[model samples]
Structures are given as structure tokens and as C-alpha cells.
Target: MNDPDGGTAAMALGAAESGALDRDAADPGHRDRFLIPPARGGRYSDSAYLAGNSLGLQPVATRNRLLEDLGEWARLGVEGHHDALRPWLPYHALLTEPAARLVGALPRETVVMNSLTVNLHLLMVSFYRPRGTRTRILIEDTAFPSDSYAVRSQAVFHGLDPDSTVLRARSADEVRDVLAARGENIALVLLGGVNYLTGELLDISAITAAGHAAGAVVGWDLAHAAGNVPLRLHDWEVDFAAWCSYKYLNAGPGAVAGAFVHERHLGGAGPPRLEGWWSTEEQTRFEMAPVSRPPASADAWQVSNPPILAMSPVLTSLRLFDDIGMDVLRARGMRLSGYLYELLEGIGADVLTPADPPRRGSQVSIRVGTGAAALCSRLSGEFGVVADAREPDVLRMAPTALYSTHHDCWRAAAALAALLPEVS
Candidate 1:
């Protein structure tokens, strides 16, 4: 049967077996930028790394770029803040333009600062306001754990009970209906741009319009969406959004995260927020004046000085994105992810991620009976394919567009087919 996205299990299986798909989609040179881990026995030569959703492969350029900053630090010490190449004082600016393009925000509206959750809380301190009856926060049932915790804690910090105040939606339509019905009572609508576990992309524009019509502020956790999918946060009029750089952005682990605030909230209309030295205007920041003159942009949300070491890799990855461009990368991702879905379907595994190209990104999640965890273990241990398992019986395989090729997809699917009988 042909899937709605024009994917056919039979065709995909034939292609995998005949190696036609691999030959057609393989780009030998693209894989060179990433440093793939050495697999045991050198099986498959390069390990079928399908875990960019969890943690992306390191960019080969990241080491040399980081070394430049480290060398400057060693040579100049405190002087590195101002004197060294890519000086620490304005280091964060390097991320501004390209980071803005990655998420469809203007340079001023986007800032690379603390980790995802930290940026979320900082944005919340300014955007999430509950008064009288409108004291609730709306979120999808499956939002990332950190987003839920941060939203719940924000409610409690304002002395509101989470049980009564945090609303959960199971689908995009439900989100709109809830906003229409309870928007008056809901102070904020925070949902993931893409559901992490299921890889179901949400309709940010539709939901944002619904929330705004109901007088509720809307924000998105773009943790799984940022580099995996194209975003138009500014055009969508999303009140705020944040995402981590460690996944599709490939900035290594625990790298600096990014935040976006609508232009409307940047200047005089921006709400009161937490203050920090980095949030102040750069020119007067050194003056150490007691007055906090925050810049008229998302940088006002920054709480501390940028961590140069952590920020270096982020810049490296963003520059790569700039070179490849989101439109090209996203088109490649849709094809790769769809091919993986077809292969998984042919193997008789239930795919959880949406088959609709617009409703999913690079990750394809599967339900491989009761032995899902074992299947994942064997896919790595026995077959040299690295996939992740979620809970009772779900396995996630992400074929990142940057380094993963059609051959990687075939190898992973072939391994799944080979291992399923043994594990089951």
C-alpha cells in the first residue's frame, strides 16, 4: 500500500535490497564533515548513526574553531575578552545573523544565550503573566519534560496551583478549540514545535493565531524543530520560542541555546524581566551603572556573559547551516526521513512519527513489538546501528540530513529486519 506521503513499502524494500536507493542518494563527501564514532569490527565502515534527535555528530571543524579561542585564552588571559581574535566581549554576536536565519527571526529578535530551559524561564519571566482568572498555562500532553516542569514551576512561583492551571492538548485541533474556549482564562500557550518522542510536528501558525485571537500569549519549545525543520517564528507572530543547539544544530552536548522574542516585545512594550550584566547595553555595560538599560532586543533576555568555549561550536554549526541553507537541508531531510519510514513499514514495525512531510522532520520513530529495547540494543551492539528506545516498546531512528545518507537508512532498516526475529 502506498502511504499518503507517496511512500511505498514495497518500493522502498526493493530499493534497499537492490542497493538502488543507496546509490542514488549517497553523497560520499557530505559525510566527511562529521566525526562518526568508530564501530566494532568496522562493520559498515561508518556506523549507521541515526541518533541526531538525541545528540548530533560532532562537526570536524568544531575542534579547530574551539582551539582558536583556547589559544587566545592561554596567550591573553583576561585580555582575551577584548584583544583576542573573535574577542570574548562580542563573541555572542557571531551567532546572531545565521542563528536568526535558522529560525526565521531578525538578528535583533534572536539571541544565543543559556541552555534551552534557562532561556524558556527567562522569556517566561517577561512574557508569562497571570492575573485574576487568566492564570493558567496551556501545553500539549507530550511536551518535553523540562518544558512542562518549567511551565508548572512558573505557575507555582506565582502562587497558582498547576493541577488546575496547566492545560494539556492531545492534537493541533484540540489546541485551537481549547484556546478558543479558555483563552480568556489561559495566560500562556507553550507547546513543542515538534513532539520529541513521536516526531509529530505541530502547526505553530494555526495555534499561534488561535491563542492570539483569544488574548493568550503563545510560545514554542523548538527543541526538536530548530535545525530539523524550517521555522518562521517572527512571521508566525509567536510571542517567544527557545531551542537547544546540541541536537540537529550539532553544537556538541549542553551547548549554548537560542531564544526568540517578537519585535513587538523588544522595546518599550517589553515586560519587566530578570536583569543581568550581559542584558544591559554593551557600550554602557562596563560602566557598572546601577541602572539596567537593556538593549532593545532579545539580548535583553540574556542573564550572564556568553561562555566562549561553549559558544564556539554553536557558531561553527550555524555557519555550516548558513552555507547549506535551510531550504536545501529541509528538502533533503524530508526525503531521507520519508525513505526511512517506508523501510520501517516494510519491516512490519509500526511507525509513530507522522508520515506527512509537513508534519514530521528527520526522525522516524517505530514500535517494534514488546522487545523494542532489546532491538535497539542489538541494533547497536550486534549491527553497529545506534538508535534509541523510549519506554516500553518505541525505538527512534533519526537520519540527519547533514551527515546521514540514504545508505545509512538502508543499513539501519536491513539491520532491524535481521535483528527482529532474534530479539522477538
Candidate 2:
């Protein structure tokens, strides 16, 4: 059958395995830079890894750079702080510019430090100030567990009821409605840039503007958004944002995360921040004075010395993104994810992610009734299609642009068809 573009239906729809292979040949991504895992239970040699959203595949350069950092530690011991190749004292500095480029922020507005939740808490120390009747926090209904816990704890720390202080909205429209109605009561608006489970990409600029109009400080959990989508945190006028490195950033597990504080909130007599040795100005940090002299940058938000070892992988990953660029990656991601969504729909699977390319990222989740865990295990162990399961009945597959290919998406769809014959 012929398609509207005058190509065969299979070629146009990307339905056949050969069609996927053809697409890969025509539009090969940066797959060579990553190490693909070997298949455990399929005819193919490599596993069609679709779980970059959970934990990204290791970059080829990660090991050598990591070993080099370790070598510096062994060679210089205590002296490595100032004398090492990258210099442990300023190691985190190497990551700042590249990370800033990745998330579209100024160098002074971005800092790589601590875990995601830790950064959120530190930023909250300066941003989540609850006073009088304007003490509520607004968040999405499907906020990640860590975010839910962190916000609840913050409310508790402020001597307020968690249940009463936290308001959950079901969608972006609801968020707008809540802001319009109870805007005065909300002190902060914290939402995910991309919903983890549904892969929905919210309008950061619009939301931030709305929150500001309502007299609320806006922050974003970019754990799934940072590397997956293009961001302009500074241009968006975002008050603050935080993201982990292990997911779309492709750093190692529990790697050092990053935070962004808009330039408007930096330095001066702005909101008070929790301070430490690192928070003090670099020139006077060694003076050991009683009063801290924080810098006029996002570095003021840091509370402890950065772990050099953890920062190594993050540096490598950020450099990779810097070289390739997020704009290039985001475009490829939309094409790949759109193809996978179409294939899944052709097989009669129920997708949870938005159909429109602009509303979602690389992830495509599906409702598989009960046994979602069992289905995911079968996909990995039986078909070598690595996907992740979320709780009762959601299975997620991400066609990561850096390493994933159309052939990998084809394998996943074919596997689902074989396993779920009833649906097919």
C-alpha cells in the first residue's frame, strides 16, 4: 500500500523491522559514544534498552575519566586538593559552565552540588518562606515521592500541617485555576518540568509567570526534564530548579546533582540561605572568619565541599551534552519517541504519554493492566527489551536520542506484540 508521501505504508508508518533499520541508517544518532548492553534472552546480541529515564547507559568516556580522578587521589593523597590535575578545590567549577549550557542558565546562576532532594531543601531554605495566611505550597498530583516527602517535611519544619499546607493539582489547567483562586495563600509553586510517570512536559515559562503573578515563588524538579528537554531557566525567570544526573544526564547512580537560582535572587540582602565553608567567598574561605561572606552567585546555595569522585562522571556527561547540544538531541528525541508511540498504538497498547510531541519527552508509558512488573521482567529476560514498571500497572520505555535507535523501538514493539497476544 502507498502512503500520502508516495512511500510504501510500512516505510511511512515505520511499522516493519526493515523500515526501522532503514530509518536508523538514514538518521543515525550518537549511539557510538555509549556502551550498549548485551541481550540476555533474545536472538539479537544487544538489548533494546528503553530505560534511560530510570538510569542512563554509561558513556564510553566515563571509566577513563573516573580512573584518572582516582589516580590523582592516590598519587597526591592530601595534597590533591590544590595540586591535582583538575584540582579538587575547584573541580566542581569545571562542571558549572557545561551544566549551565545544558539547562540554559548563566554560569553564576548554576551550581553542581549535593543530591536532588538536598538541593531542593537548600533552595527552599531561601525560597519557601511561609508567613501568615500565605503559607500553602502548590504541587502536581503525580509529584515524585521524594518531592512529596521534601515539600511535606518543609511544611512541617515551618510548623504547619502538611495536609493543609500542600495543595495538589491534577493538571496544568488546574494549577492555573488554583493560582487564580487561592493565589494569595500559596507561598510556593513546585512542579516537575516533566512528569516522571506520564512523560508530560509542562510549560515552564508559562507556569513560572503564572506563579509569579499569584505572588508565589516558583521552582522546578527537572529530574526528568534537564537533559531530556530544552530549558531556558534564566530566560524563563525561574526562581529555582534542581535535577539529578543519573537519569537523562547519564551520570552514574546517585551522582552529584545540580541547582539553579535566578540571578535576581543571588547575593545581596535577598532571602537568607543556609551557609557553610563552601558558601563563603573562595578568596576568604581559608581565612576562617566567624561571619560568612557568600558570593554574589548560586554558589552561595552550596553548604558543603563537593565530592570530587562523584563530580567526575557528571563532568564527563555534561561535556558530552555540551559538545552535541540539547537542541540537536531534543529534535531527534521527538522523532524517535513519535515513532515508538505510533508502533505501540498500532499494536493496540494504551499509552499514557501525550500524543502531541511538544507535550512529552523521550519516555512513552503504557497501562498494562495487572502484572506490570511481571510483564517488564518478561520483556527484559525473555525478549531482551529493557523497560521499567511503575507500581500497579504502568510500563515505561524511553527511546533516548543519544544512544537509542529506531531498530531498538522496533524490537520493543515486536516484543510487546509477541508477549501480549490478546492486545495484538
Candidate 3:
């Protein structure tokens, strides 16, 4: 059998596996720090996990750190608020600095709070102001379903029909064009830093500047970008942003998410925000007055008390990112994903992600036409390659820098070749 690159398939595969092993030896990622799952079908003992973009593997330190917080609760009962090891009263404050460092924001501009979509809605309350002519929200055509739902609901909340209030652009060029031609009619521009299905990394700084030039508020949903790529939300002057901690941040499922509001909009005559008990200044929070005096910091966005238990994992993960840094992780991600892309091309797989390194994150998506779900099942059961499927046609595999290896990419590519022998 011959590969699409005009080589004997068996010989080419042997050399590819050898090359992958050598690369792994030269560049061993932080795989030892994570818990790689046991294989379900292949000869190898451990599964080659390529699904980190969906859910990251657990860090070895997560269990111990989480248990410590649990132990404090067990020991202190109601007094845990002030008496626990890490006091629950100001527990969320522990995450602020590291979370700020992760997204390149000042401590006052960042807050680790509510779930991703929930935080989006909260931020929109302050950022999305629909004036007389500027009444539509601009989003990507491939925006995540949750973001689509949130923005549409925001339109309805303002007594506007969603169909006319939400505008979907297919690319960054289209976004810029929309801002130029219909800037006065667009109230907000909300887009993903790294698109979920296609793995396209948008130019955050340029797009933000364009939106500002057009007099529209610009924001981002960094669910796939926060930890996968380096970001400078403050420097870019992004009006607002939100990200989940579960994916490349490795903070576990439904972990506490982070939000950022640029310094220009901090306080003193900024747009109005929905307020609650926690929204008030901590110094006077216990005064329990009828009116709330919100602080100037992003903490003013908080509407409820921090969930100590749920926040523990986020703290642990953010500290890891702070220590290793996104620059190092991003460089390693490019190397690994570039190798995977080469292998996929050799097998004649139809890749959906951009080939340019700067235009993408760690995720590599391919067009599987149909039966993507079943193909993913076969990859896992027959070869122990753990990749994910996006409904009918898209298959996404991420070679996360923190744990994935070149050999994992080789496993995924080889498995696909065996399953799809006629691809060439």
C-alpha cells in the first residue's frame, strides 16, 4: 500500500513512528505532571489523549489541593468563612492575581467568578448598550451555541427582535467590513479568540481596534483561547472578555470562569451593571444598607459569594499556568500541532484548520464528511486515540502542550490511516 505522499505505507509509518519517538525524547512536555488515562483497546497501556480542547486531563496536584479545602470545611463548619486555612470570606481573592497574570490584565481588572455563559450575560449587561440606531450585536457565524443564545436573549431583553438584532459574520475580514459599513447600526462585536470548530485564531488586537474605531463595544469569548494562546486583553483595550477554566487551563468540568473589564471602564461614570450583595465594597458589605456602593474594580461585577469548593481547582490550575507561562506552552503547542498537521496531510485527511501557525491554536480539526462520531469511536476502541467529533462532519484533535506528545499525534494519524485506507 502507498500513502498519498508516494511512499510505501508500511515503511513510511515505521519511519514516522521512529521520528515521533525521537521528537518526544528531545522535547518531553509536562506529561509526567498529568494523569494520562489507561488505554481501552490498543496494545499501548495508556491512551493517547487528543481531546484536551474539550476537557483537559487532571493534574497530579489537583486531588491533594482540593482535599485540603474539603478538609478545612470538615474541620471548621460555619466558622470556615474566617477560620479555615485559606479563609472562605475572601477566598476568591486568592485566584485574582494568578488569573490576571494568565490573561495579561491588572489585578483590579480581572475577577474569577460564575460559569462562562453566566459571566458573558453579566458582562453584556454593562457593555451591550443598544442606542437609537446602533441596536444589533455582531458575532461569528460559527460562534458557540451558548454565546449565540446569550446575545440573542440580550436583544430580546431590550425589546428588540433577535433575528434583526444579531448579525453573524463568517470571517474576520467580514467582521471588519461590517464594522466599517454598518458601524452605526452595530451596538457590540462579540467573537471567540480561537474559533471552536475550525481552530482559527483571530487577530484580537486588530479587531478590537477596528471595533473601537467604529464606535462599537468589542468583547471576546476566550473559551478555547485563554490558555491555548497568549492574550493581552488590557493592552488591546478590549471592552470586556470572559473565558472558561476547564479546557487548556485543566481546571476540571464547570470550574469557576474568569472575566476582565479594561481599566478605562472600571468605575466612575462607566456603564451601569446589575448589582447584588457581593457587588458592594467588601469594607462596607456588612453594613447591609438599602443601596449598594460598588467598588471601582472588576470585583464590582460579582453578584454572589464565591463558591470555595468549586474555586479550589481553578486556583490550582491558574497557579500552574502562572508558573509555566503561556509563551512556553504556545511555542510547544505549535510544534506538536504542526507535526500532526503534516501527518494528516500525508494521509489525505481534509483538514479544516488553517495551515498557518500564527492563525491557529493547539486544536486541529478535520472534515470527516459524515459518521464522525462513529469514526471517533473506532479510533478510541481500536487504537486508543482519544479525539472528539463535532456532530455530523467535524473531528477535532488537540495536542495540548502540557501533556500531549509527538507519539500521541503519530498514534492518531496512524489510526486514521488504518480506519480510512481509501482516503488517498
Candidate 4:
């Protein structure tokens, strides 16, 4: 095996694992099931599965955990809320210790709660305070659309003009320029830890430093980056950050989201934010009090009782991370993603992800010229590659660490090289 095929064995193993999971997923009689949807014409088993940046594979443990939840409900009746087999009263707590370690946060500063947009809005309410002239937000031009929408809505919520209030970085240098010139007016800087489209890993520590220098708060949307890279939210001195666990975290679709509010802000009687009964003092949660007094940490940001079922998948996925460890996962992600990058480059593909692994994560965004989207379509529809396409061009492939093996990279690159001319 050469540059184009060196990773074959690894990828084949990954494909085989996917096939076994698919077989079990599709068969109702199998122990536990999930439907990953076959490649376009069933040409591949699970479509190369390189789009973990969009959604990771369902961990085998997820189905079992779900079954256990059902079993708990059956066995505990109404007591499941406080005295179930797994003890729902403190169920969310189980994830805190490991989840904190995964993203490099103190247990007190992290909490698994509402969806991404919802958490963003909540954190903003508490952390996005602006007075006099400091009231703008710095975000990336290439950020995902959902994020842009939420940021704009938040600006409106604060009676600010989206056009002037939303500061964007067209390039890394531009981010610095904005920080130098108008950072004083910026109350907060929100960025994706890794650009979802280009897969460029932003330097959060440096960015946080710049924001602080500008006297602006810094936060991040880690949807595509959290599990793909190592983070030190507390050490970075970040004001806050939020992420969805479904993508790189492999918690399955619509899994409960997590947020981190650095300990600097937690010890008080909660930062100022929206009111939810669940965030109220636990001792008086059911006292039927009319007022809401939020908890003293990130948990205080909650606005509702968490959807236990939505969060259950995370427990399953988190256990796997606890078993494998983030340092190990991140180390492998860099190596395998770099291998994919090398394989793509050997075929003369344009690399959209930053060449610096320090500035890249698990995904590689590559350009197959004008037909990259078509190439990506074919990878799924014809060649069984699960790569996704962004607008204009750029096929985004994320080789997840937990389930993805080295060989999948080779198979995907080979599939692309084989299909380019046809797409052209």
C-alpha cells in the first residue's frame, strides 16, 4: 500500500464494523437496532460513514442504554423519577465528571442541558451583557447557518441591530483586525472551535486572550469540534461555550446539548439568565414556590427539567469516551485525519482544512474543483463514500475516532479518485 492505499486495512475494519452494526441495526430481531440508511444504491454498507462532522454513528452501547431506560420505567413506575433502577434524581450527575474531563472543564462549570440554540440564547442572556458602547459580537463568516440565525435573533432580543452588532472574521487576520479596531464595542466574541465547512480549528486560547484584551467576553460553539479536539475551557479563561453531542460526540441525533460556564462565574447565586424551575434551588423544587432562584453553577442556566430520554444516549456514548479517554481519541483523530489529508493530497485534491494539524480537528474539507458536490454525491450514491458536500464545492469528511478506522480513509480517497472523471 502506498500513499493512496496505505490506510486500507484500517478503513476496511471500520467498514466491517459498520456493516455488522448495520446488519444489527436493520434487523428488528437483532439485540438493539438503528438504521444508518444504506449508501445511495446499497453499493456500500453505511455510506463510507465519513460525515461524523454532521452526525456520528450510533454507539453500540446506545441501544442497550435505551433499553435499560425503558426497563427502568417498567420496573419503577412513577418512582423512576427519584428511585428508579438507575436513580433519575441524580442521573445527569453521572455524566458531569467524565464530561468535564472530556472538554477540560471543572465539574461545577459544566452541565448537560437544552439544545444548542437554546443554550446559546441562555448563556447570552447571562454572559452577553453590554453597557454604554461595548455591545457587539464577533463570529466567523463561515459559521453554520443555524448559528448565524441564533446570533441574529439574540441581537434582536437585546434591541441591537444585527448588521452592526454582528462582527465577522473573513480571515484569521481579519479577526485580529476587528479585535484591534472595534473590540472595545464588542461585548462578546463567539466562534466555532472548528469551522463546520472549512474544518479550520480556531485557536480558542489566543482568541480568548484577544477578546479579553479588548475587554470582550469570549465563547464558542463546539458542535463540530468538541469530541474531535482537545479543549481547556477553564484554562483558556473562556466566559462560556456550548456544544451539541450528536456530531463528533456520537450521542445520536437530537441528543441533549452541553454547556460550560467557567468556574469564575459559578459560585455566586447563579449568573443572571432566564428562569426555569429546574434551575431553582433543588431543595425547594417541589415546594410550589412562585419564585425561581437558580442554582449556583452552570446548572443554574437550565430553563426546564432536562429531557431525560433525549440525554440517555449521551450516557452510553460518554462511557465509551471514558473508556477510551479524550487524549487517546484526540491523538488518533489527528493522525487518522492527517492520513486522510495526505491521501487526498496525493490525488491532487484541494485541501480546505487548515494544513496545520494544530489548527485542524477530525474533519478534512477538500475541493474536487467545481464538481466536488457531485463527487461527494457519487461517493454516497455510487461509490459508497459517506462524505458530505458544502455549497459551491468542498466535500467534508470526518473520520471519527471511536468507530472510524485508518482504512476508511483509503477507501474514501480511492473512491474519490475513481469517481472524479465521471463527475467531471
Candidate 5:
């Protein structure tokens, strides 16, 4: 079978016993750079950690990286801005090149900035302009709640009714149809690059073209898409995008996030946005002039000086991405998740995520009958598996390419099979 990222699959692991797992282990070399907790036996081993969709495991390099930054801060004090290792003045640039590689954007179009929601609001301030009759906003009905809230609040800020002005589409085809009919009235089209609940990967390039054809600006909330899959944000001609670093990027919890604005939007005629001293030219930033002269890059979206300590872990994780590259990781994710899907199919549970290889990421969200959350609890406590439960019935399990193995997928599937009679 062809891999979703445009390569032929070398081999796909259909079951845990398949030697494909052994082959993948040597090539990508899993479970070494990461530090997974030992299962109760006092020996280090990978537990069934299937929750990268919610929070990723820590990279071992993060500790030394943080200590280095702290030591520099203690040694140099105020002088660290220019004198210490990784000079504080230009620290954010350290993450820019690797991050650009991960998202398929040029360095000039991307910036490591505030958290995901903050960047979303900041981008909307510049792009969500509702003039005269084009005052509506479009989002997926299954979008993460924070995205929906931000779009609704933007509509309200523009004096439009949240109920009527914020429209919801159920699928990609629906987006194209609506844009043909009502897109002339749309101020913005913002949707999740991957659905958080169902693990659906949307057709971003197609949607962006449709939105532009109808004269509406398009943006993507890529919190679930950024590092899980390969993205061509610039080649897709995306107007703007924002994503968090805590999930597949494997930065620490609530780590700093990132934003991207096309080169076309960074020029003098670009849309107006809220600015800070950091958005100005570095040579002139300390001048403290009253007027704003924002640079012609995505860095102009920065609202304040970055919190350096919070950004340290991002460097540690992004460096690993630079080493392994997105192509290998995405291919491994397909095999790992495909193994889990085969196991789950034999167990008779309803899998909500798309079965098509190209239409989904590494996650497999299962729909249990009655006690889904409690089943997840049992899977964690008794079976030593860690998967997340979303509300009533969905259990999201992600077999991350960085740390998880085919054995972990088998263990999780066996645990679910054992608990199914009680859950059903």
C-alpha cells in the first residue's frame, strides 16, 4: 500500500507478532530518547502509553536543556541577554528553522509565539474582518471547543449574533458546497486541521483553495495536526495557522506555541494586527518610539517578549524532530495505528476514526457502549495502559511513533478485549 505521505510502505505491521515492529525499532529506534516509567517491576519498559493525542511523554534531553538555561541565568543575570550561551536576545530563533521544517513553511513565515488559543485570537484580530454583508464565520461542528468559542466571540465582537453568524459544516464536501452558496458573506473560515474527537484529517489544501475562490480568508487551528502529520502550510497557500507544542511536539505541558502567516500578509499592505515592542525591528525596538513599524514576517504577530524558561523545552523536542524528520515519523505512525486498528476490529468495538490511511492520523478513537470513562480507568489502573476518555463514550488512543511500539498497541488491544464484556 502507498503511505499517506507519498511513499510506498516498506511494510505494515498487521499484528504485534509481525517482524515489521522489529524492523521499525532499528530504523526509527524507539523508546530510547524518551523516558517511559517502568511498570511496577523496577525495570525500565514501555507501558501502554497511548495518549500522545492528549499529552506527550517528556523527551530526556529537556532536563539538560532546562538546566543549561537556568545555569546561564544564574551566572550572567542581566548580561545574559547578550553575553551568555544561546544569548537571550535571539533565543526564539533557535526553534524557528526546525519548526519551519516540521510544518513545511519558510523561516520568514513562521514564529514561535504564545499558546494556541492566544495565537488564534491574535490572528483573528487581523483576519476576521466583517465588512458590510460578509460578516459570517465558518467552523466544523466537531471542532475543539476553544476554537468554536473564539470564533463565536469574534462574531459577537463584530456585533453579529453568535447563533446565526457562526456556521458549522459536517464534512469537507459541506465546506465546498457552503462556500459556493454563502462564502461571499463569510469573513473567515477556520477549522481544525485534525478533529480532536474523531481523529479526522481534513483536506486542508482543497479547503483553502475553495475559501480563496469565494473571496474568504482561511485559517487552520492545527493543535492536533502540526507534528502528527506532514504539512505543507506554505505550498497550500494558507492565509494563517496556529498550533500548540504540548501534544505530538512533546514539549512539556503548556509549552509555548507557534503561528504562521503567509509572506503575502507580512508586507506593508498586510492586514492590521495588535503589536508589541518585540514585533518591531530589533535594532529599533529599544528606541521606545510611539508609532509602530512592524516587520514583514510572521514575527510581527508576537505580542510580547517570550518567556524564555517556558520556551526551553520546545527546543529539546524540536531538535529531535530535526534529527528524525517528519517523513519517517509519519510512516511509523501509520503502521503503529494500523496494528491497533486491526486488533480492535477483531474485538468488536466501534471505531469512530476514519479507516482510510490518508483520512486519519495515528489515533484510533473507540466508542464503547456504557462505561467508557470507567473502562479507561480500568485500562490504566489494572492493565497499565494509559489512554484518554472524551466525555461519554469515546476513548482516544494514539500510538505515537516517537515512543510507542507495536507491542504497546497489542497490550492495549488485549486489555480492551478483556474489559469489553463488562463495559458493554
Candidate 6:
């Protein structure tokens, strides 16, 4: 249900056009850099694009790659698998370097594979070995439904009761308390690098240390954090992690996802992996022997072959990230988003995400009061500002760096201010 008062009816566009703050104007030429929907009908349509943190706009390069791949298919026939310029034989491997660079890890430590939820389960299968007293798994209470479901199912698969094995933390104090109280019994810690709904970036390094102190393996779900924030997964000593490329990475819908296993956790020197042909030894990969020799690295975790169509989009997207660069992109994101935060703060909207610039990533979540969902609906329906709403009170807005701009942020802030009077 929307707010009974409908606060944004007149104020939506009014607040957006109300003399945007000076900082909202990024440098002249670059100002229109990622203007995707290009200004249609006079005003601004990039404002309709604040939802990249949810699903990114399709890059023009992505479309071109798709066409190129389709052409290869039409001309090369069945032999295309080996005859094509980008051979399907080692397609997944091609993504290793760029993907590893994106998340800050050694190439062998990362592999573009399965969906986020599936990879989480596979990583758990290898890492979540429960011993006598150390059988619990620590997870966030507000984790995405997919993560929560995978954790619980893994617990059941281990012959442990989910009720007893699932330990949860809500607030910072609660998190500290759970780790202290049950640290000795935790077998694995599965946390999101950045939460899906709240957009809270977790301290993976600190949490990993705490979990390890208790003799537990620590893994993170970076579905929302992977491309949106700077991550040093290898440096942080993470045992394992997984993320979808569709969100911040802006791969197409349901695009191939990626996972990481610290170099220390690969092959015989590593934890027990659930294997498949893709992770088979390259030397004897086509020998079709009765016995299987696992790949030397994290590739050992794969249980099946990869889908090439799904990976092409990911390849194009990462190239763009490399071209634009994550460091430069992230810095602008913080500054531009910080301005958005002030604009919302100025209107008395309660910011739920951390205010500290370093702690937060690309997203800024807000609690716009009792009628938050309704106001959000109106923002999309009436104003064409494509932000998303979270349950009872929160609205999540992220100005992605690769495609989003300063003017987009200003427009969104102005839209919110316009709706203030109607709700109040």
C-alpha cells in the first residue's frame, strides 16, 4: 500500500529541478559519459537509471559481442567449438584474469561458474566440514533469501539440524555476542560482503579473523559487493566466496557467476572439492579415462562444463570495467553518492546505510518513514525514477560509477524532496 497522503504527487519533479547542488554537475565532457537512456523528452532519463546496483544498463559493447558470437555460430557450424576466434574449449578460462582483477585475487583462485546460490552450496560442500563440537554455521539474519536457503540446506545435507547449526547476528553487538558465545563451535562463517537489501558492507577481514580464531572457515557471498566495492579477497585470506555478475558487474540477466577459493584451498593441498569434467586435468582432459584427476586450482570445484553464451556478456562487461577502471570509478561513486546522501539528509530522510564514506560502497539506503513502499512505487510509476524499495521502511538507491552520473544523483534527490510534503 502507498502512503495515504501521496507526498510526492507535486513535489517529485519539483524537488529534482529545484536548483541541484553545484557538486551534482560532474566535469563537462565526462558529465554525460554513461548516459544510457540518453535524455528523452527534454528533461532527464538517466534519472530513471539509479537502479544499476540492482541491474545495470546494457552496455553497447555487450550487444556487439552478442552479434559477433551469433555470427561465429552461423558461419562456423558444429566445428565452431574449436574453430571460432574465441574457442568455446577454453571460454570460461578466458574470464579468469579480468574477474580475478575485479575482486583482487590470483587468476587461479577464481573461476567464472554457476549461479550465486549454487556456488555457495558447492563452496560449503568443500569447506563446511563439521567436527564433534564445532558444527554451527554463522550467518547474517538479514542475508538474501538465496544465501539463507543454501546455508540451511547445506546444514541438513551434513546430517546436522538446521535449527541448531544456524547461528545469526543482527546488530553489531549481536554479531559480537554470537561469535563470542559460539565461536568455539562454528564450523564455517557465511556472510555477504555487502548485504542485498540494506546495502551494508561487512568487514570481511575482521569477521574472517574472528571465525578463524575459533577454528572455522570463513566465506563471503559478494553478490551485491563484487563490482560495487573494492575487494581484496586473496589478501583478506578468505576461504571461499561467490557472486553473480548480473548486478554490479552488469552482465546480462542470469549471466554466468564466479567463485573464489583461496590458493591455499585448491587441489590436494586444499579442502575437499566436489568435482566435474571442467575441473579435470588439462593434460588428460580428453582421454576419457575411468579415473579423474582434478584440476590443480580452484577449477577443481566445478561439477560441470560452462555455458559460453552466458560468459560472453561477462567478458564484455569486465573489459569496460578495465577500460573505465574500478579505482577511478569507485572514487567518483563515493563522492557523487556522498552528495546524494547530503541531499537526502537535508530533507530529513533517515539514512540507514553507514554515513562514513570509507565503510559504505555504492549504495545509500534510507528509511523514508511509514509509507516508504508506497512512495517508492510512486517514484517509479509517477516519476520514472527506477529505485527499489525494501520491506516496511527502507528504500535503496545506488548511483553506480560505470554507468551512473552526478546529474542522475541530483535528479533522484530532487525527486525525493518533491515527495516529502505529500507524505508528511
- 1-424 in candidate 1: lDDT tens per residue? 1133222433455455556344544553267898998654326666889999999999999999999999999999999999999999999999998999999999999999999999999989988999999988999997888988999999899998988989999888889888878888989999999898899988889889989999999999999999999999999999999999999999999989999999999898479899888989999998889988999999988889989999999999999999988988888888888878877777776688987889998899977657777777777877788888886788899889898878778878777766555444
Tell me the tens digit of each residue's lDDT in model 6 across 24-79.
44332133434365433225454457777778777777777877778888889777
Q: For model 4, how big is the CA root-mean-square deviation? A: 5.8
Where model 2 places Cα greater than 4 Å from the true spot, the runs are: 1-15, 422-424
TM-score of each: 0.94, 0.96, 0.97, 0.89, 0.93, 0.91
Considering every candidate listed, which one attains the maximal TM-score? 3
C-alpha RMSD of each candidate structure in angstroms = 3.3, 3.7, 1.8, 5.8, 5.4, 3.3
Error of 3 at 392 (Å): 1.1
Tens-place lDDT digits, model 2, residues 253-305: 99899999999998789789999989999988999999999999999988899
Better of 1 and 2 by lDDT: 2
Rank the models by TM-score, top first. 3, 2, 1, 5, 6, 4
Query: How far out, in Å, is residue 272 in model 6?
Result: 2.0
Instruction: Estimate every model's Cα lDDT from 0 to 1.
Output: 0.86, 0.92, 0.92, 0.79, 0.86, 0.78
Candidate 1 off by > 4 Å: 1-15, 20-29, 422-424
In the predicted model 3, the residue pairs found to clash are none
Which should have the higher lDDT, number 1 or number 3? 3
Weakest 10 consecutive residues, lDDT, candidate 1? 1-10
Q: Which ten residues in a row have the lowest lDDT in candidate 3?
A: 1-10
Model 5 whole-model lDDT (C-alpha atoms) = 0.86
Q: How far is candidate 2 from the true structure (C-alpha RMSD, Å)?
A: 3.7
C-alpha lDDT of residue 242 in model 5: 96
What ranges in model 4 sit over 4 Å off? 1-46, 371-373, 422-424
**Candidate 4 C-alpha lDDT tens digits along 48-118:** 57888988778676877888888988988779988876777667887887788888999989999888888
Q: Which candidate, 2 or 3, has the higher TM-score?
A: 3
